[model samples]
Target: MISKRPVHVHEAVPHGDEPPGCTSRVSVEVGGRVWLLDREADMEALWERMGEDDLGADERLPYWAEVWPASVLLGRHILRNAEVLCGRMCLDLGCGLGLTGIIASHVGARVVAFDYEWPAVRFARHNAALNNVPQPLWTLMDWREPAVRAHGFDFVWGGDVLYEKRFFDPLIRLFRHVLAPGGKIWIGEPVRTVSRPVWELVRREGFTAELLTVEKVALCGQNATVNLWEVTIS
Candidate 1:
């Protein structure tokens, strides 16, 4: 019964062009409960802005501004399996809009969520308040040089983080460094050609993975299936 609906405008103020930092609020229903989230109002505008900007190697566009289907699928899975995560240490990587972390907190998991950009972390904090969940430790973090402790987490998860080929090896190293003994990892992803070699790569690194579930998701007039995989050290 997950649904996405537009926010009603109580006071409409007309403007020619949307300004920077302009945002929209959305309601996402998961596990029979509605959660509120905020995102950038104009995706194309942000992309255009990024095009004109001077950027470093690590900095990228505002891909975190939109709620992707993988996040929804992971959120749904967390809400449904709340009991298993209760009191467990969980980390949400690239926690865009903080939906999965908030849902995990609601179900009583100690959550630590991080994003590459500060805006995404800010939005996650705000969304946690909106959803009435205990705020997780939301931090601005670059996964390439993470400032986290070794073997610190029990369950580390991410949604749609496998978009870039360069990140594959770094991500696997991060997983190995941070995951505690007997800990697990879950990744939710859409059907993508670039992601086809992921399992083979992980298996080569001595990790085992299995498809846990597939969820059909609709976003912005498109329908697709999101796959969730449970991975662990072999």
Candidate 2:
């Protein structure tokens, strides 16, 4: 179990009312160290909240509630190549739970992390403070219509962000606008059929895309192969 959330969290809900929601704290191991992360305790309930709150079409589901293996893979890779991240200006694009950004900040990088969903940003900020590391400047921003320009990031990275084709253009726009000259974008995702076209799209956009590594990780109650894709301006 990759730090499984407890089946039942906190005190019970009273009779004839909505089930109480909670922030489930799980201890996660990243780069040979234990860090505490707080996540929404019930995902299905969170999805219902998304619908009730009108959280936009992009957030059709509460994908940010769990600690994805892709994020864990990125965290480990950052430790393995700490030299590349140290003192670098990095952006944790679409950062959920802020694991990658937190680790980057821990290893001495100046990081800016953002998520479209406010709940995700809230928990990421909480987790960073819980870990007692240097906090990232968390922003609630939409990639499609960014309120502020994220200029000059040496590295722009995200985990499991290539699942949808609709975001390919905006992602490229971010890379072109925010990434510094000779900057790199690393995205981590489990091998899924839907993600196959993203590689071709990367080349079509004139960026050099390569398989940085294939990390074998346990994800969603199964063993999965996570492809760490690195893209850069050609």
Candidate 3:
């Protein structure tokens, strides 16, 4: 079941040195526009806390709470093509810190940002507020849910969501279900072995697929290449 309730981080007596909701401010520049994002200050500490709190496998790791390089590239791409977003209804699938949806909202698109993790949804909301962008509808939802399929999105954006081969089929099914007529899906993925088969499946599904751009991005102090792909049903 999908929950629309927003989670708040309350300060309780800490089991360790750092309490929950510890965050740092990060400024990102995309196409001459700047967005300020708030992220967990220490991911390792957060992970430990998650373990203490007995979060499940998906929630135990705070991977969704950090800003990823692919997200940065996707934000840049959205800002570069801002005009296309005006008056569009967009979806940010598995939005981590909500950078892509925030950029889409900044560019005048009506956006719905979704993540399966409640903490991630909270952080995404906080990031939107931090940047002074209009808050998109933040929902804690799994991609395979019937609620997710109910929305007709004109453009669906995701970053670094193609890393696991196990999720490819579900992701593709969700994309096909949510996309409106004449809609497009934009994905920014780091070059990985799993990405090839996913792309091939997308092609076999009769979508017109193309590699829109490839650029080097700095991730965790290391340079990596990110490829942006555009897909539409033919």
Candidate 4:
């Protein structure tokens, strides 16, 4: 995995719960390395007790669970198979905490990491520093819009970003737009049977798709099943 880079820490928020809620911490492992994050607290409080708590923005998100299957696969694949990433230009999309991008950077890929949520974006940047990876280009972006500023990435990655069927189309559209021809798009998602249509669409769009070996992913210390998606861009 990438070496930890120096973090540009933001001013810490007041140490108390506010309007929506407080912040919790989650440690996402990419490859064998782990990153600690102070994230916006969820109503369930799954990650709140992991460590010290801090307050931050609490905008409702579609998927706010502590453990994610997709991220595990992305991390494992790149870490266990470093040759897939040597010297590649990569994008880590919907990069909650930036684990996948961090792993890519560690393996010598030049990476750009992005997420829409400020808290997640902040954590992503911090994780890059925490893991001692090369400083990745970071950005606040809505993948649904035209990403005119970023182009020609050899690889694009996302994990567990397909929970809502409504967002799948636009997400796939953005993947098609950002990846260089002959590049790769890898996504890790749990077996949400509803995602079959999106998989079919990816295949129809001329990208080759395959499922990786399913594995038990650790989240907040518990185990969960995760599936991997490897998309070969034409």
Best by lDDT: 1
What's model 3's overall lDDT?
A: 0.73
Write model 2 residue lDDT over 103-186, tens digit each, in one string. 998999988887765566667777787788887877666666655456678888888887777777777886778878888888
Point out where model 2 deviates above 4 Å.
1-22, 48-55, 148-151, 219-221
Q: What is the lDDT of residue 30 in candidate 2?
A: 80
**Per-residue lDDT of model 3, residues 1-234, tens digit only:** 011111222221112222137367667666676777676654566666654456544444566766777888998888887899888889887777778889899999999887766667677777777788887887667665626544488998888887777668877887888899999899988888878888889888878889999998764577879899998988
Cα lDDT computed for each candidate against the true fold: 0.76, 0.73, 0.73, 0.64
Task: Highest TM-score: give the candidate number.
Answer: 1
lDDT of 1: 0.76
lDDT comparison, 1 vs 4, better candidate: 1
Error of 2 at 202 (Å): 1.3
lDDT of 2 at 196: 87
Q: At residue 197, what lDDT does model 4 achieve?
A: 81
Candidate 1 stretches greater than 4 Å from native:
1-22
How good is model 2 by TM-score? 0.85
lDDT tens digits by residue: candidate 1, 1-234: 111111111111122222236378877767788788876654456667765453345546666677788888888888877898999999888887788989999999999888775557677777787788887887666676666778989999898988777778888998998898999998989888887788889999999989999889776577879999988999
Q: Could you tell me the lDDT of residue 24 within candidate 4?
A: 60
lDDT of 4 by residue, 117-231 (tens): 4555555666566667786776656676645344588888787776667767787687778888778788787777777788888778777888867787766666777788888
Candidate 4: the clashing residue pairs are 2-106, 3-131, 3-132, 3-133, 4-131, 4-132, 4-133, 5-129, 5-132, 70-188
